[model samples]
Target chain A: MTTVTQEAGAPFGAAPPPADGAGESAIVTEGLTKRFRGGQVAVNALDLAVPRGSVFGFLGPNGSGKTTTIRMLLGLVTPTAGTHSVLGLPATQALPRVGALVEGPAFYPYLSGTANLLRFDAADPTAPRTTARRRVAEALERVGLSAAAGKRYRNYSLGMRQRLAIAAALLGPRELLILDEPTNGLDPQGTREVRALVKEIAADGTTVFVSSHLLAEVEQMCTHAAIMRTGTLVAQGTIASLSGGLATRVRIETPDTADAARVLGTFGLADVRSEAGQVTAELGGHAPERINAALVEEGVAVRGLAVLRPSLEDVFVGLTGEGFDVDG
Target chain B: MSTVDTSTSPGAGSGVRAGEARRTPGLVPVAETLETTERHARPETPTPPVPSARERWAFWRLLGSELGLTFRRPRNLAMLAVIACVPVIIGVTLRIVGGQGGMGGIIADVAGNSLMLTFFALSFLVLLMMPVAVTVVAGDSVAGEAGAGTLRYLLAAPAGRTRLLLVKYLNAAIYAYAVTAVVALSALLTGLVLFPAGPVTLLSGTTITMAEGLLRILIAVGYVGAGMAALAAIGLALSTFTEVSIGAIAGTIVLVIVCQVLRAIPELDSITPYLLPTWFTNFDAVLRAPVDFGALREGLVAFGAYIALFGSIAWARFSGKDITS
Candidate 1:
């Protein structure tokens, strides 16, 4: 499936076969590593497989090698060791079909938004020049920047610059879109719009590999995610699968904490603890309703109760052992 | 051009609408057309059946866009404007000081014939001002993009590393020629309007017709342009080393100034032939009655050697560089 002949006939401009055995994953990296000068390991031996048509969020903290890895994938930086492929082809060969926005939006300050896009479009050897104008217009429109298209990039607000960067990635019909911190400077409403845009792009059958330190962004928009700490990948899987690994916690608020703890202990829950006026335990396959019913029958006087399923934030914190910016 | 042929083909001709339709379920039409386009426009070598004109146009398209960016930059335009004004200022100053007691060398010759001003200005400016202009453009070619963080996007646009390097070099070369032409034209116009126009006295004491004098000026323009192009190559090589454009620009200027300082030292005359600055004034060969082709050719060869050496250095450094910027 990794044979050259299969990829050679397609070139980069051609659409990658969506359901073929060779194209099942939009991106696959094996032991991809990058060690900078002075012996700084920015990215350790990491393996990543991003399924096609899935919105995969690459979650990591600042200085966690997310941008460095993206640079390597785009051939902007040479890897220290290992190999990677995009759309089942070598990164350079597959780059024409891949649109990327690394770090942030950058353009000639004197050039208008439209002009900057035109210059970028000209850079891609595969993009047809005949329809370049229309594609640039459509891209700007998609990102809701058509009104500001004629404005100089220097005059754009941070959010507009972020949107323009996304628009640049959308300039062509791409098989894979790699956006690092896509919503970094965007406001809340702008963030929501970008999230919707990602979902829209994913729905159109394009694989999206987005990197961000915002835990809520990944939890809300990503189907699958990989978490990185320092220079190593800590965890990776579908969002549900990752969250599923953590136990569901049961918290009950009552004046009779000791009685509630005894009651919860009777249900065979794990780590039952009573402190102050609160009793908490790992639900561990126990139904919330049944526990609530048993507590009432036992006259534990349950005032408030919450069966909390751990969010992706908790999963990330637990895996990396460091707090993340859960709000963006 | 095959743009007319292939673009008008039944499937590929429908341009914008087909592209717009691709967003929907009509991906097959766009995909089929793109495959056909790629089949014809294969990288490096177009298939044998593809029209040569289209291939040539594709080669120039990227270069054209690059040239547009370079020329449209206000900073570059301002530099060129300053270069143009240098000849005007020199010509006007020579005109006001016509036959003054201290007037000597090229200034006396310029006061006698209008066309001599063009030659004198080329000799005067090529030393530092012209090289500075070319260096600013060439040095900033890659590093400017790096500084502004646009180089990453350009490369990821998959502008092949080698091709981008070639385009940057060409862009700088074109600007170099433009700088030379601007100084020559501005000086020629300033000279003609201010001084008496007549047969030019050559360095060999032979008089040449106005048409021949203009031709000599054209030759000097080209020679100086070549010399500046060589300097541009050095600037480009330095550009590949750093993300700070000013560093590359200043480094190239400093190298040129150092060479000039070395050339001025009579004790170091043995190393004069190897220095780039020593050959820049070789355009003075045009001032002789029968142009000194031997000297001009030697200068050109030196320029070519400089270009080759620095160009390869730029390619090797840039192709393997980690574009962290």
Candidate 2:
């Protein structure tokens, strides 16, 4: 019955980490670390601050400790060091309010989808039993799983299983919903179905922490994103902010590529590359106008020019040298 | 605590609900109650006072579900079939062979008195089948969940790890008791039809009436079930260490068997009372007319000690484990 502990400064204790001036955070972790036996560091000194009501993307490649980090945040895995809180309470207490689908949804293969939802709902000591029937129906209906409610889980397609797991998360009114690769192994239609559901859930004012290895999925679904690599967080912020830090190449096509390259080189822009009649350069702080003006001043015919912004996928590869499985 | 979605934004089903929640007057602190069943977006129903953690755990629904899952499995039914067949085989063989060699001469009595069949079945149930069956059930309860990828979701439920472990253990215990009772009941029925029904003589050389003897058999059935609790704890303890149920089940049986082998060695007689399965074999000792509580008492102490040692280990391991699956 005594859920919260005061040892080592509980993360929710009037701490600045969890406070969000614009909106309260559903999760906050300060240097959270986990070192498994045999001296294997699974997750290293993670510092996370997830704002409430945002669809936060946890982006990392396979074996990057994304699931491990989520487990630690959900209290399924205790941290070797550091502290975390969910919804302004210690992990132990805040976790109950969090509904998670870690590494895909797992349920008794023998039970019907509806029965599994009921079983999970009943497991929550706080879930009221009287309205359980209504809740189950609503969850299934909302997830578009009402038809498969009577079907056994083993018989469900990967998509149905994922949706059922989402229904399990939706069985109660949750403040924070943590999904780790909710779309893993799903077909395109199933992936789209799940993405729509996540948006809906987040729209309901629940802070969603969704982890995935797909950059395109994160770009499409998340308002904010955090990238991890080899068990450590490399970068994190709003999708816009993370996108802002990466370089946007200035591409130019001209009849005289050599002249353009030489004139563009006057600005000393980083990484200038030229081929045939086109030239591209990472004009970090130089205005596209300045590059164009310099080229025109030197009598280079500029046929076309554009400032191309980096997509989230480009930023992802730049941040972690590994290209994500886009749209999969 | 309760806010029905009232906003009318385009594509506003979830939007309205969230807006209502953020703007709702005097919402219950998020920490107090997890009142999150989205109820038809109707604002008329009064918010129910959410139950405390203690109140939630008190609901028997969780135990019922686990019990249903464990006992309803095909493998569990197969185990019950094998156990049920034990009593039938004993009864039929005793009726045909007309010999009482098993259990040091209790088999012959099983022919005339159905009540003594429980006693005849005791050595087999306690020493072999009960422990194995219990290990399977208890071991599979937690580790199996982990392997199936359900433990991560279950841990995030409102219940704490301590409570989840308790519910799982209790469900397996119920299965243990059910298995023991089924065997005793089967033997009793087989003895009645295959042989005659009359008075039963306890191993202590005292005579008891038929009705009292039947009552004693029921008590023995329950008592044997109690003895199996130690094995359940061992199975659960082993379960917390691995995601594979077979590993836990096999590990439990191996550990218990090693303990039994150690107890059998004359050199280890000094520590005989500390063995895991020694008290397990004492299920028959309680069937005597003047039931001796000394052995049963010592057995209970040993059982409690095993439970405490292994139960705490399970809690500690589970509390800290990082569930990658």
Candidate 3:
């Protein structure tokens, strides 16, 4: 993944024009900016268009303004400049139909999971109290927390706490769900469960906007992703479009590494490197068969050749000029 | 040329299938995973549904939830229990001493009648104990939620900022009344069991019927409760300034102490009436016949002024504040 670091150029950082236009975007921000009182810009002029019905992943390394951006999108923090809309309405006005778990799961530590959900549900004026109890129970069960529904939040394991936060967000049918670092403290099994739950929710056509630093999580769960670094968007688009924009690399293992590198350099491939009896280069719009034929004609024995598509991690690092932590 | 790929990106569906398999061991069977999916897919109206009867009353529901949380907290309940015990301790100790040794003034008055002990305890607690108890509830209202990181959830629940602030203030106000009632009831009970019950002696040296004396104590409780509620408003305002509950709690207590300290200075007489604690003990006006409406009204107005001023401060600070916590 780190083998290539091509400059993404002007096409990056520019807003991804949604295929169906602004009407289909669940969230739209126009130069949204947030500058703290200490003169630090946490989020700077972000123009995001989260397509409707897409599992949009706001991927960034730690402290890259992921939480701050989520907070501003949810109206927990007001932006210093520009405007943003959620679910086709102003952020605050559309909040009733939006369910969010910001930063982490937070509830009355003394109250049971069931009671905490009841209180959160009560706070939503649009949520009918008539069905609150049943809804709360269903939410808990959906997150597989029924066994621990009566457990005090303070006594819960970290995974249980994370699940309960998800339960709270699912209390009502939300048109938009904004979750920041949803799987932060969960165990590996719990993390997989949450990823599945996110997919299930997104499959139902609810636009899910999830922010995380985990590249694997985003790669697996998201249909589209926006990469952030130092408060500005590095790149964003459909998962296929993001990776498709990068060049496919050609790797050949042979004893004539120097000859293979020389032949590949003559073919004008990018970043051709020879190491340990192997040679690799970005085959940008080049025929792999032609490259192999040229290598063989030049007496460079091509023992084996493989073409590799750059992963999302590679795409992000290329755009941001920084390696994102791939581990959970 | 054939392509050989080593790394395979996991499909989204495989994870869901694995999740489904693992979910079979969940305590409760997951039934609505598909049901809710269909529910969300249905093309619904663009506008929000008109609220049902139950939803219309959600304000009161949230208030009830807030009150339940406030009263149910072990810390707040412990403070209340301690407040109740102070009056009882004062009554039992007074009874043991039996008005011997010229303890004088309120002590001698309390020895004369059981009802006077209620007034004596109110005077003793209104200055410090009651303020501390009220501050604990009100001071922690917003700051505690922020400290625990629940404030963001509540705000995102779209608990309108103004509405949330109102609920916090009302919760504190209700708790203040609870504290006052606890003190008065405990004192009244202990005094009746230990001291003589009869017509009460007034500060004016006039004796009134036991029924009238109880009425005066009831009025005094209201007066003190109102004062504490006003103090709670100040606590709520301070609560909005920080994420740490202890900071707000201590800030409120320090303000009250500063007011009391200023009130004690003879040269600061001009500013004494403006201090919240200064009017706290003005419930003594209820002891006079026909109820000294002038003094009582002045104290009520002061309390009202404090509530109005600080309540606005809290609303202004809270509504525009960013919830980073």
Candidate 4:
């Protein structure tokens, strides 16, 4: 549960780059840019390299181009400029092995889930009838929605609808699954289920690219992450690596909080707070053991000592100068 | 994370766990959860696989699917049924009014001139009914999907917007053709069933048999279908502009009416053939004894031009559209 935000000036300390191979990256982009008719750039110079079989989390604030990037990656919205590839296939050439549920689950309201899947199955030349049916059933079951398989999409709850969207993405056994805010409307339990599902899928070797504002979930589920602000990628790396350079807080509870604070201040720990026999201070390059030793020498009766590691939110704010909505 | 041992119960394995075991490891858990909650997974009972895209788009399959969706709706079905009974209703009313005299003769006289009759019957349809039909079908082609937030899913399926638009247009055309045929057939049957079934004097002082009259009616129906194609194209173009089906429908209807009014001006009479509604009544020349194909030919060119123009606009709009919202 250690969380640390690596500062930009800090040396690069990411996992060793994946071995170069022949298979296409799940999603690759170079100089990707999108500008509206008015010349307002939505996504600017996005050069992303999502390795195959990794759960890549795209983090951004509202209108920060996360959805725009996802749209371009899926070819739903053509990029204003640049190139992208999904499932090792050039996005412009053809997108056969890519399945995405961008924005929301959109299905024919009048058609039953089975009918909708059937229509989609019929739309793809590679999916045979028997295989499509089996896949549809399998997908339905995977989203914990077999019981509501026959229900009209109009009648489905928001969470159920989100699940259906995921189920649709699951169809055809796609090589890459791109989901944007997949757990948008899900309750806590539902969110956990989806998080676990994403992890399982990634573990199984399918490149899963997801975008969300849920920092906690991203911290838990993503092996690699990209953070965006004002239509630019400000940070990209593993969670642990991103958090490594953030300030660490040490909270100490002692018989005499005032004395502990005074002792820490003498050591140049100017930012110290003492309340109710407890003291907390920012520890700069100092270990908990060092602080404990100092307190013991000062005859301070320490009852408890804990280090508070920076979470993803803190790291994100540090990099972007703005905090993302955790609930999003 | 809780070690409650929930897996021991018979139903414990009935949800995501049971389903996940069968799928590829990458997608197992998702498949499992969906299977366990089948009730919420989809809106229909799972069925056997469907034909591939190529097979589904095979001529007959596309046609059948298009026809099924068109006529399945009660409104469309009723329109067809009403059109079929038009001739019978006209005949019955004529008979009740006694022999061809007074009000009956007036009705007969109007119906006697096949061109005038075609115009009279379709004026109501073109002014409102046909627009409504075009709106009902083409307006919703893309806009409805967008409104329902399904456009993203459809696009993600990698469905080319061109193909989707083509399918929707073709579907609307089929319904339009069916509607036209029903109306024409009903008029012919009613005219035969009610009026004197024999050679009739034409406005041009030529004579024609009932068989010729029926042929003329068919031609009129074809013209109406062509006119509807323009309406469908307009609808499609509007559909691409906005996600509001009602807006597309209303906009197309108003545009059609405006075009019709413009075509009526004496100064613009030469350009009338290019207008969808103007050519709609050009079915008149078909009633001549020797068959006057001049207006019909011009009307065809006009219809084709309208289709090309409006169809191109729709294609361009949809191709560049950002459907992510």
Winner on TM-score (2 vs 4)? 2
TM-score, every prediction:
0.88, 0.81, 0.86, 0.78
Q: Write the per-residue lDDT of candidate 3 for residues B235-284, one digit (tens) a residue.
A: 99999999999999999999999999998899999998788899999999
Candidate 4 accuracy as lDDT: 0.71
Off by over 4 Å in 3: A1-22, A258-273, A283-304, A325-328, B1-54, B99-104
Tell me the tens digit of each residue's lDDT in model 2 across B48-98: 212223233335888877777777788998998899889888888887777
lDDT of 1 by residue, A210-249 (tens): 9999888898999999998888999988999999999999
> How far out, in Å, is residue B287 in model 1?
1.9
Indicate the worst ten consecutive residues by lDDT in candidate 4 chain A.
A11-20
Q: Which parts of model 4 have CA positions greater than 4 angstroms off?
A: A1-24, A92-94, A247-249, A255-299, B1-100, B103-106, B109-128, B188-213
Candidate 1 at residue B19, lDDT? 47
- Which ten residues in a row are the worst by lDDT in model 3 chain A? A1-10
Rank the models by lDDT, top first.
Answer: 1, 3, 2, 4
- Candidate number with the higher lDDT (3 or 4): 3
Instruction: Score chain B of each candidate by TM-score.
Output: 0.82, 0.79, 0.83, 0.71
- Per-residue lDDT of candidate 3, residues A1-328 (tens digit): 0011223232211222222224788899999999999999999999999988899999998888989999998888889999998867677766766889898888888899999999998887667787889999999999999999998998999999999999999988777799899999888999999999999999887789999998888999999999999899889999999998787899999999989988999989999988998999998989999999998899987899999988998898788767886564
Q: What is the C-alpha DockQ of each candidate?
A: 0.23, 0.23, 0.22, 0.15
